[model samples]
Target: RVRSASYGGTQMRYRLQAGATELHAAAPAMHAHAPGNEVTLALPPERLWILPVEQ
Candidate 1:
């Protein structure tokens, strides 16, 4: 489920969750989205990034 989002001119920030896993991701803004919406992502592996957080 999508919790929140910020859509800029050409990019967007999305907050989504599945079970106990939550993710914040950025992508090009081409469509409109809002809270409580379920989304399916088909990101290409070569264009995806997974950064590890250091605490």
Candidate 2:
């Protein structure tokens, strides 16, 4: 999970991997002054893969 703050709002990126495949997903652009202070995305287990291991 990676979070970035911008002038307008914040952006989050989540990447998941399964076996040799990887899945990258992120939330929609959330504008400032929005209602919620937190945003969440529910992803399937198979679709969520952790970062690749570096050698």
Candidate 3:
């Protein structure tokens, strides 16, 4: 469920929940992020980064 969102000029902040987890994501403002609205997340390979965890 989507909690809330704040729209900026070219980006927006979104708060969402999935079970016991809550996520705050930032992305381009190409769509409306109204409160209580459901949203889909897509991360392409070009936008993905892999980092090694320190032991």
Candidate 4:
């Protein structure tokens, strides 16, 4: 869960990978993301929930 701060406005890029499979995602941070505002990151079901080991 991404808890955005008050008066937040920025672009966020996220990348997730497992083994040979990888996923890239981007979201537009809204300026109105203030107070109780939050952004939730949902992962794909096809990918297994494993630890990402960097080589």
Candidate 5:
């Protein structure tokens, strides 16, 4: 999952979770990160994509 705050605002921190995994994550402008199968985060106008992981 992904979430975002405006580029010009009180910058805050966020905690991301998936099952038992937790990530201390933040988006500075257009941050894009993909860490696993079917997960993507594009932020600062938060966008998310879950693409299939081909095996």
Candidate 6:
């Protein structure tokens, strides 16, 4: 699953998850604009494990 949030004016945050496990996470640092209003961030992939939640 992928989730995204926009901070207005070309700022956004994205999170990726898979089956109760987080795959990648990233947040915008500052407002930046590219040639075609594109922003990119490099993030390392992290290993995630699913743990049972006690209710």
Candidate lDDT (C-alpha), each:
0.83, 0.46, 0.79, 0.46, 0.46, 0.45
Which candidate wins on lDDT? 1
Q: Least lDDT summed over 10 consecutive residues: which range in candidate 2?
A: 31-40
Q: Candidate 2 lDDT, tens digit per residue, 1-55?
A: 2233333235534454444754455554563323223434577889777786899
For 3-54, candidate 6 gives per-residue lDDT tens digits of 4444544444445445585433334547423323323445444644456876
Write the residue-wise lDDT of candidate 5 on 1-55 in tens digits. Answer: 4332233343434455556765455555355434432345445534544457579
Model 3 C-alpha lDDT per residue in residues 1-51, reported as the tens digit of each score: 678889978998889886797777777898767888877777687977666
lDDT of 3 at 50: 63
Every candidate's CA RMSD: 1.6, 8.6, 3.5, 8.9, 11.1, 7.6
Model 5 residue pairs with clashes: none
Which residue window of length 10 is worst by lDDT in model 5? 2-11
Over 1-55, each residue of candidate 1 has an lDDT whose tens digit, in order, gives 8888998779888988978988887768887678899988776899777888878
Q: Could you estimate the TM-score for every candidate?
A: 0.75, 0.29, 0.64, 0.27, 0.30, 0.26
How many residue pairs clash in model 3?
Answer: 0
TM-score of 5: 0.30
For model 1 the TM-score comes to: 0.75
For model 4 the local lDDT of residue 46 reads 84
lDDT of 6: 0.45
